[model samples]
Each structure stands twice: as structure tokens, then as C-alpha cells.
Target: MRFALNHIAAPNLSLPDFFTAAGELGVTAVEIRNDLPDVLSAWDPAQVKAEAEEAGVTIVSINALYPFNVWGGDLPARAEAMADYAAACGAKALVMCPLNDGTKVSFDSLVGALAAMKTILDTRGLTGLVEPLGFPISSLRTKAEAIRAIKAAGGEGTYRLMHDTFHHHLAGETEFFPDWTWLVHISGVTDPDVAVDAMLDAHRVLVDDADRLENVAQIRALLDAGYDGPFSFEPFASKVHDAADPKGALKTSMAFVSAQL
Candidate 1:
């Protein structure tokens, strides 16, 4: 299985340092967060592309565009610009997230957004990886919903669902979509005492035996069910940033996950 590291996993590191560390850890790809310290958004497209190529790292996908379904006016232009940036950075896809404030965007609106985004993606030769957030406030809560929206938008080959373990658990979804899933974000919630309702992005971290969430088991099931995609680390735990050696922490986490595979 190919391994990719998310920039959120080591938020303290610079882009060059993150790439170097990922390379040292034998990771094949790295995902960048637009909201993070070092990102493609901060650099010129050419420079970003050159830096990634020189570091020998591939850009898996841009972290996300929030409330993508409610986008209007300049949103399409912004998405197009981001897609162009991704192309310049040698990225494979753009991760689009749904509204998470319980605004109740209709399924038809979601389909419309996907169709609009797919048009932009097709024009830029990029793929749209739609990710559904499972938080109570989130409008979209399952990969199944995302899959249906993609199909409804007539984006069969242009778009795919991002299967996130944390959200899958939060959304109470038990089924897997091996054929339509393009990427998988693997992270676990370690605190059992922390109520599931209160869990947020901050609870994310590398999968471990102590995790209250069945992350490893879920991943195994996905693999067994024919998911042939990269399992990227997307830990949002603050400890990852506070650790003395983030690369060492990543190595330890990778070892743990690899054993399960």
C-alpha cells in the first residue's frame, strides 16, 4: 500500500521540511492544507511546482474548500484558480467539503455544486474528491450521500468520494464504497471519555491500539473490500505538533498502521 502524509499531521513544519521529513519516512506523497503555515497559496504556482518536483514528493490533494455546496458568485472562479494551482503543483485532485453549519442544503443543490465543480475540474484536468463531514452540524454526513450527488451531477469519472474513517464513524455509516472511493483519510479518536457528539477535528490522530474508534479494523475492512487507494494520515491532534520529533512520531504511527495492513 502507498502511504501519504497530510500537512495537518505536522503543522509546525515548513513545506520544505515537511517534504524532507516525508521523504525520510519513505512516504510517497504529501497533502497540503491551504490554511496551514506553509502552503501553495503562499507561493507562486511555478515556484510551488518546482519545489515539489525537487523534493521528490507528489501532491496528493488540496485539503479542502469549505461549504462547497453553497458556493456562488466568485466561488467558481476561486475553485478554478485553486484547480490551476493544484495542476501547477502536480497535485492529483482537489478535496471539496460540505457545509457543516446545519444550513440544510438540499440534495439538488449539492448535485448542482458538484456539477459546477466538475465542469471546472474537467476544464483544468483535475479530479474533485468530495468529502462528507459527519459532524452533527454538517449538512452532508456520509459517503453514500456524496456518491449519490456525484452520480446525480453526471460526474461519474470526474468526481469520487473521500472515505474518512473519523467521519464514517461519526456518521454511523457501516457500508463501504470500494468502487467510488478515490482516497481514504485514516485517523483515530483516542479518548473514549470524550463524547462522540463533542468530537471535532482536534480529536484526529494517527491510528493506535489505544484508539477508542475502530480505525484500523475499518481500514482492514476497506482493503479487504477492494479499496486500492492511498491511506493518507490526517491526524489533527495537537500532540503531533507538540511532539519533540514529529517525523519520529510519524514513523511510529506508520509502523503501527503498516502492521495491521
Candidate 2:
């Protein structure tokens, strides 16, 4: 039950402050993001590396390279740039998300994209954490599909799955790939009125007794199946973002999840 924090959990906090908060919670691993707080746009890679060291926290990953299944049109350049930044900042991995606009990308394209990105990640000694989006419109909506693409691309050594609890529920995934997973993103959706098909990032909130996403079950299953990794908090709700004491809220949620488990 290793816990970690995602920058999205407290986008308002400065990078150093976020690190400090995680430290207060006895968490030393964290995921930073290029969006939300957009640390990449605001801080130099060397600065980010130095700050993480100063805070005594490890930068587990950079949130992602989006629509990664689309291989052309500057995607390669962007992928290289992100991998370089990740290496420079001492992050271990880069999260890769597929296209989610209902535009279907061929299976060959998915494999080709992964193969191309593998070279970049390998050269930098970084892992590509492929996360399949679960929205109805997502081009790659299942970890099984992602696994096939990774195997086809011969990227098993350079890529791993990012099992996001929210996406897992939305994708209606019944199987767990613990051996292939290196990270897990956990959030809860508690809106009683919102249908499962209608759930969005705005509905994501900290886990509690009212959580409807079965986060505990998902985690227990993963652990039982031999997954030993971090469970990062990634609530995207505005209510969470605007919290007056984000760290306190996160701490409370952390306790609740731990108690339930």
C-alpha cells in the first residue's frame, strides 16, 4: 500500500510546496505534470530536479504525452522533448495517453507509435507508462489492447501499464495485469446522480466511504495479484482543486482509504 501524490491533487501548490506536503504525509514519491500546474512551462528541468532532491522526494513520473497513438505531425518531436525533460528532471517515467476523440486509430498505427516512442524513452533510460483512456470515444480503451500494441512494437522492456482506477471502472476492465503495471492512479466518483457513462474528470474526487468507483476493491485485487507500486491521488474535481487546505483533505482521504483496506 505505497501511496503517492499527483500534482493534479494540488495544482494550486507550488512544486516545492507540493513536495513539502507529500513529505508531511510520509510520502516520498510523486508524479509531476506538464499541465494543471504546468511545472514544465514554469520551471527549468534542472530546477525541478534540484527541488525534488531538496525535498527528498522522488519524481516518479511526468503526467503524460497525450494522444500518443497519433504518430505523425510533430508527435515525434514532442515525444523526444518530453523524454529529454523527464531525464533531465530525474523522473523515472513518462505517462503516455492515447487519442480520445472518437477518431479510431488503426492497430498498426498504435504499434508503430509505440515503437517510435520506445527508442526515445530507451535512450533516456525512462519507462513509458502507457495508460489507456476509458472514455467511450477513446481510441485505445483497454489495457489488453495496450499490451498487444506494446508486444507488437517489441516495447515490453521499455513500456509498462498505468492502471488508473477511474479508467479501469469506465473501461469495465475485469482483469488485472499486475506484472505489467508500474503505477496506479486512484480517484473516486461519488456523484449519486451521474450515470457511469456520463462520469467525467470533473466528477473525480478524493476517496471516501461514499466512493462509487470500488477503489478499495481494485487496489486489493491488484495487491492480491502481486502489484507492489504507488497509488497516486489524481482528483480532478474543481471542489478538490479549490480546497482551502488541500493537504489536509488529501491526508483525510488517505486515512480513510487505509482504514478501509
TM-score of each: 0.96, 0.99
**Candidate 1 global lDDT:** 0.85
lDDT score, candidate 2: 0.95
Question: Clash pairs of candidate 2?
Answer: none
Clash statistics: count for each candidate: 0, 0
Top lDDT prediction, candidate number:
2
lDDT of 1 by residue, 59-98 (tens): 8899787778986977787788888888887888999999
**Cα lDDT of model 2 by residue, 1-261, tens digit:** 999999999999999999999999999999999899898889999999999999999999998899899999998998999999999999999999999888999999999999999999999999999999898999999999999999999999999999999999999999999999999999999999999888999999999999999999999999999999999999999999999999999999999999988
Off by over 4 Å in 1: none
User: How accurate locally, in lDDT, is each candidate?
Assistant: 0.85, 0.95
TM-score of 2: 0.99
Error of 2 at 134 (Å): 0.6
Clashing pairs in 1: none
